[model samples]
Target: MSTTRSRYTQTRSSTISDDQIADLIYKLQQLIPDDQIHTTTLHHHKALNTKVLEETCNYVRRLQREVEDLSQRLSELLQSMDNNSPEAAIIRTLLMSP
Candidate 1:
């Protein structure tokens, strides 16, 4: 019975894998000075990676929500149209006319 439309938008953006981020972090660690590199730096990289992953997951969830909302709306519309309705009769006549 809910008619509120979903505001979610589908994004076709590609996501990077955690393994790839790990590889990049490993490579970055090798580039930094041994003395400058510490646990904090690794932690920061991990935090940033987690943030990106969460964003991607949220984006997917939003898209799914939008799809589900649209599907529900379509189902509601179809349910409202019985065979005796004018629109339904028109649709039937159109199909049979051809």
Candidate 2:
């Protein structure tokens, strides 16, 4: 009787975990654009997840580079302005704040 109860508990727990995993994977898939999951299998979902993650990483890196370039240009432009100007002082103060 104990063995049977243990098996039943384990099976139920596993099923719930599987459901949770599927739900998370579905959410992740929805976040990535152009990700199409055609099959209802774990392998296909895993593959799509990997692809989505790689694409997201690459996109984030590209955006970081763009932000860095823009920040550098802004700093240079600010430096070229007259240091005594009210506008430059305001901008420099804003940039220094968290």
Q: Identify the leading candidate in terms of TM-score.
A: 2
Clashes of 1: 0
Shift in Å, residue 70, candidate 1: 0.7
lDDT of 2 by residue, 15-40 (tens): 33435545655687667555454455
- Candidate RMSDs in Å, in order, are 11.5, 20.3
Name the candidate that leads on lDDT: 2
lDDT of 1 by residue, 15-83 (tens): 345576566556654565545547668777666656766576667667765766665555465457784
> TM-score, each model?
0.42, 0.54
Per-residue error (Å), model 2, residue 32: 16
> What C-alpha lDDT, on a 0 to 100 scale, does residue 53 get in candidate 2?
64
Off by over 4 Å in 1: 1-40, 82-98
